[model samples]
Target: MVDVATLEKRPPSTIALLEEMERAYKDLPMEAIVKQDILRQGIHFLPEAFQVIGEYKSKDYFIFSFDHIPLADLKDGADTKAPEEIKIQGGYFDLLKTVISTRNNPHSPYKMKSVEGIPTLFLGDISIGQAEYPPIPSWYKHKTKNGKFPGEIAPVIEWGYLLYLTVFRNCQYFGKDEECAYCDINHNYRQQKGAGRPYTGVKDVEDILEVLSWVDQEDQVAKVYTITGGSVLTSLKKKNEVDFYLQYPEAIEKAFPKRWMGKLVAQAFEKEDCRKFKDAGIEIYHPNYEVWDKQLFEKICPGKASWIGWDTWIRRVVDSAEVFGPDKVIPNFVGGVELSEPWGFKTVKEAIDSTKQGLDFFMNKGIVPRFTAWCPEPYTTLGQQAGPPLVYFCELLRAWKETFEKYNLPTPPGYGEPGPGKAVFSVSAFMDVIGYSGRN
Candidate 1:
């Protein structure tokens, strides 16, 4: 068995691990490796660090809890105080600016502590990096007519480059057997409600519109908006999955008529069903394939495997390319899940080879697949097991970048400018690996 005790040690340092990855994958950016390691290992903060992060757009518990620990386990109230994301720069490695989504893991080797009244990340007393929290957007200071917070209706991520609207909070993929084994969406909803936060279950259309109006009028940074929610196997508010999610984009477009780039994250639909979303004014489509290997896909995402099967899902993703055009149909895979315990690959090489096949399959057809580095939240089934090694993620990013350039694909739309130091998509480094000219 792999030793958890050894992995959790603060000696050897985060910088050392990053240097090892840098040596192995020299072509991949040092920024992407550190970003992936911070994601895989997570980060800790001193109490004073929270006070320093005071009102700078704290985490909204958007979609999933995205925490390494459960809501019930946070005795120090770090959940409420943690910043939405942190930008790392200037340390032993002389790193470029790298943005990483926050995932709370108290035992991580990387910890955020205050030094001379400023927040910094340390590895065994060595200051590996300096950190900066995203500035609170102007719209966050405004409240809706019914007294709803802007955070509840719309939350900005990627340094306010995208507005995230999780229209229906909960997924119908209920219970341990039915829901994706790696998912914490249902549990996150319950925790947010239990914590007495004003998290709306099924957000009203007008409420979303009201928040968008504020963003459109006052915010200059936001360039895209994604309308998404949990999987709806049956119906939500008496509407099918497609119809329910389609309404948000439809209403937004009708009201504003293409004011910003629009995207949708939903279950895979037939070509005809996808056309309705296109007709409704959605410019980009993300039908996340979760995992690439068939057995792992079945075991990890049981609902998707049972409902749609891998072959049908891939076909629909390709079919939708005809409707939305190849560049606009970007499917996502959860990057490191192929190495999860109980059913995943036994080694990093096998895992990367398997995922590389999926990348070639998609990109060969002019469709590009994106990924988010997996975080094992405490409530999900997979969270009961440990996540993959940092090596797996480093190798995966290298492989993904190789395939993407092999196809000579353009930068996928909706996401802001790409390449190291310029990418704002925090969850994954795929954006960080693309070539950019800084012309956003």
Candidate 2:
């Protein structure tokens, strides 16, 4: 019999795994299947492929490191050379344009190579698709009056459909006891500083406004702006979490006045507190509940459990629906985290069942839940571990799609178009699987 370590070291063939999952989940688009695999495992860039760095929007360390390996471990300056995201199309799969966020994992079977002088994505020796990097926004050329790069202050993600502003780089939730087990916000900040990147700890409102002024004047592709960062537990700059976070949208809407779809990702708040964001012109709210399992919530999110308690968190999420309206009050869970090691469910069935329950609870009330495919980045409390199988993500996507349609819900605002190929929401296939009518 093969030893567990040997079995763990050798995964089933990549193409074979895709084929098996395709047959098992035929309703899910092939585009989404491939996207989820890349998101979970990350991609390694060849030296030749790294040549495209300056020509495109490179990874900005926008929030978390979002890499399988830390910056210290990545060779050949991949930390700075990797593209913010890649769009895959035309290969063995004849895939449509699918945008996927970049996560560097040198060991991932998927590799970015310059195949015959063309940028390409490969699984083992098989070419998956022609890879296209996002173009640099013209405004990225300009610096804030204080000498800040636009990408550092305000970066565009989702193929330039969303402006990602991480105002507070460091979370007040310090140490393993307080940080989310799978998160690396605090660690990513340290690695960035260690690497001598000019990452800001806390961005001033004026600096953010200055960046947006350039964005507003020069860009038209950005349809939404998401004001988000690490959770503010006690206080940031002497302001409470609400006051600290609320200031961004409040200032943006005050300055721009509904120029872009305004969104916020923060802790779940009471009905009245939720109104503060709504009143400030935030059209969409994302109170990300990282996982659905109750026990996992206690173990994985001890800080939140200790500070707010899961019961209160859930209640706050539900109550916020009144303020933002059910459809606009979207919540995000970290996909595949329900199956994380040591504390997670023993089987996918248990994980799916638990997550599906949460979906039903929310979707039944017109609140559509969303998720980002979990990347097990290093140095977090969970450390580096094998993420859930591709099948788990496929199942989660299906559950999300079916529940979404069951309610005949509108596409959650802020995220660009839903459905395979057209989806720019690179983090998870939840958006890609939307409106899919089974594979041909």
Which candidate tops TM-score?
Answer: 2
TM-scores of all predicted structures: 0.95, 0.96
Best by lDDT: 2
The alpha-carbon lDDT assigned to residue 384 of candidate 1 equals 50
lDDT of 2 by residue, 154-241 (tens): 9899999999999998887788788889999989999999989899999989999999999999999999999898888777899999
**Cα lDDT of all candidates, in order?**
0.84, 0.88
Residue pairs clashing, model 1: none
lDDT of 1 by residue, 207-321 (tens): 8899999988998999999989898988888998988888888899999898989999998899999999999999999989988899888898888888899889988999999
Q: Report the Cα lDDT for residue 154, model 1.
A: 93
Candidate 1 vs. truth: CA RMSD?
3.5
